[model samples]
Target chain A: SAVISQKPSRDICQRGTSLTIQCQVDSQVTMMFWYRQQPGQSLTLIATANQGSEATYESGFVIDKFPISRPNLTFSTLTVSNMSPEDSSIYLCSAPLWGTDTQYFGPGTRLTVL
Target chain B: QKEVEQDPGPLSVPEGAIVSLNCTYSNSAFQYFMWYRQYSRKGPELLMYTYSSGNKEDGRFTAQVDKSSKYISLFIRDSQPSDSATYLCAMSAMTSYDKVIFGPGTSLSVIP
Candidate 1:
C-alpha cells in the first residue's frame, strides 16, 4: 500500500471561486486519479492524471472544469475551476501501486462552496 | 440500473456482535472486488480485496464473493466501536486498474 496525502484537508469558499487540490504519494505510482464525493454519497471519478501527458476525464466531467497536472509519478494536482454550490464535495486522489489490484486513497480535501 | 447496488445502512450493532455488510452488482464482468472503510472526514481505506469467487479471511474480517449470484459480502467478527464507519464496495472489469466502480456505501455503527 502506498501512503497518499492531499493538501488543504478542507476549505470553505464562495461560489464561482476556484480551488486547487494537491495529491502526493510516498512512492512512485503508474496510475493516479482524481475523485469527487458529495456528503453522504458515493465517489465519482473526475479524471486520470497521466504522467507527462493529458489527463483522461470521465463522462459528465470536463478538463476545463477539473484541470489536472501530472509532472511526475509521485505528484499530481487537481484544480476545481469556477466552483459552484453543486461543486461542494470532498476531492480525493488515489493510486494503484505497481503490480497490485488495490488502489489507495488520500485523506481528501473537503470543499464547501457556499 | 446502477452497475452496483448496496444498502445505505446506518446499521447499529452492539460491540462484539458480528456485522454483515453486502453489495450486489449487475455487471458479471467485474473481476476485482474490494471493500473499503471510510471514517468521518477521511478517505476510503481498503479493508478487503478479493478476485473472482471464494472467501478470504484476515484477522476479524472475512470477505466473501459469490460470482454465481453476482453478490459480495464483508463480515466483521467481534465488531468494535471503532468499526463505526461507512463501508463501500468497489469493483473493476477484467484487469483495468482505472475502470473501477463504487457503491453508495453502507454506514455501520458498532456501539459500545
Candidate 2:
C-alpha cells in the first residue's frame, strides 16, 4: 500500500480563476493519475502524469485546461485553468503500488467554483 | 448505453445482514474488475479486485466475476455501520496503469 496526500483539501474559487492541486506520495512512483468526480457521478480519468515527461490527457480534457507537472517520482501538480462552474468537482490523485496493479488514492481536493 | 452500469442504490440494511452489490458492463474486453469503497469526504479505497473470472474472497468480502455475462458482484458478510459508504465498480481492459472505467457507484448505509 502507498500513502498519498493532496493540498488544499477543499477550496472555493471564483469563476475564471485558476487553482492548482498538489499530490505527494510517500514513496516514489513512476506514474500518477488524476481523476474528477462530479456531483452524483462516477470517477473520470483526466490525465496520466509520468515522471520526467509530459502528461497524457484523456479525451474531452486538454492540456490547456488541465496542465500537469510531474517533476519527480514522489510529487506532481495539476492546474485547472480558466475554471467555470462546470469544473467544480472533487479532484483526486492516485498511484499504483510498486510492482503491483493495486492503486492507492489520496484524500481528494474538493473544488467549488462560485 | 453507458459502458458501465450500476443501480446507484441507496441501500439500507441492518447490522449483521448480508449485503450484495452488483455491476454490469457492455465491454467484453474488460478482464479486470475492482470494487472501491468511498466514505464521505474521503477518497476511494480499493476493497477487492478480481482478474478474469471466478470468485475472490478477502476476509468478510467476496468478489465474483462472470465474464460471459459481463457481470460482477461484491458481497459483504456481517455488515457494520463502518461499512456505510459509496461502493464503486471499476474495470479495465488491460492493467490498472491503463485507463479504467468506473460505475456510478451505489450508496449503502449499514444501520446499527
Candidate 3:
C-alpha cells in the first residue's frame, strides 16, 4: 500500500478560472493517473501521467482542457483549464502498487466551479 | 449496452447481515477484477482484487469472478456500520497501468 496526498483538498473556483491539483506519492511509481468522478457516479479516467513523457489522455479529454505534468515519479499535477460548471467534480490521483495489480488513490481534491 | 453494468442499489441492510454486490460486463477481454469501497467525499479504496477466475477472500470480504458469464461479485459477511459506502466493481484487460473500466457503483448502508 502507498500513501498518496492531494493538495487543495477542496476548492471553489469561478468560471473561466483554472485550478491545478497536485498529487504526491510516498514512493516512486512508474505511472500516475488522473480521474474525474461526479457526485454519486462512477470514476472516469482522464489521462495517464508517466514521468519524462507526455501524458496519455483518454478519448473525450484533451491536453488543452486538462493538462497534466509529471515532473517526477513521486509527484504529478492536473490542471483544469477554463473551468465551467461541468468541471465541478472530484479530481483524484492514483498510482498502482509496484509489481502488483492493486492501485491506491489519493484523498481526492473536490473542486466546485461557480 | 454498457461495457460495465452494476445494480446502482442504495441497498440498506441490518448489521451482521450478509451483503452481496454484483456487476456484469460485456468485455470478455477483461482479466483483472477488483472491488473498491468509496465513502462520501473520499477516494475509492481497493477492497479486493482477483485475477482470471475463481474466488479470493480477504478477511470478511469475498470476491468471485465467473468469466464464462462475464460477471463478478463481492460479498461481505457480518457486515458492520463502518462498511456503509458505495461499492464499485472495476476491471482491466492487462496490467494495472492499463485503462480500467469502472461500474456505476452500488450504494450500501449497513444500519446499526
Assess each prediction's global lDDT (C-alpha) against the native.
0.92, 0.94, 0.94
Q: Give the runs in model 1 whose Cα sits over 4 Å from its true position.
A: none
Candidate 3 vs. true structure, TM-score = 0.98
lDDT of 1 by residue, B1-112 (tens): 9999998798999999999999999999898999999999999999999989999999999999999999999999999999999999999885535778999999999999
Task: Give fnat, all candidates.
Answer: 0.66, 0.80, 0.73
Interface RMSD of 1: 1.5
TM-score of chain A of 2: 0.97
Across residues A1-114, which tens digit of lDDT does each residue of candidate 1 receive? Answer: 458999999999998888989999988898899999998899988888879889999999998999999999999999999999999999999998777767889999999999
Which CAPRI quality tier does the interface of model 1 achieve? medium
Best by DockQ: 2
How many clashes show up per model?
A: 0, 0, 0
lDDT of 1 at B90: 92
Alpha carbon deviation, residue A5, candidate 2 (Å): 0.2
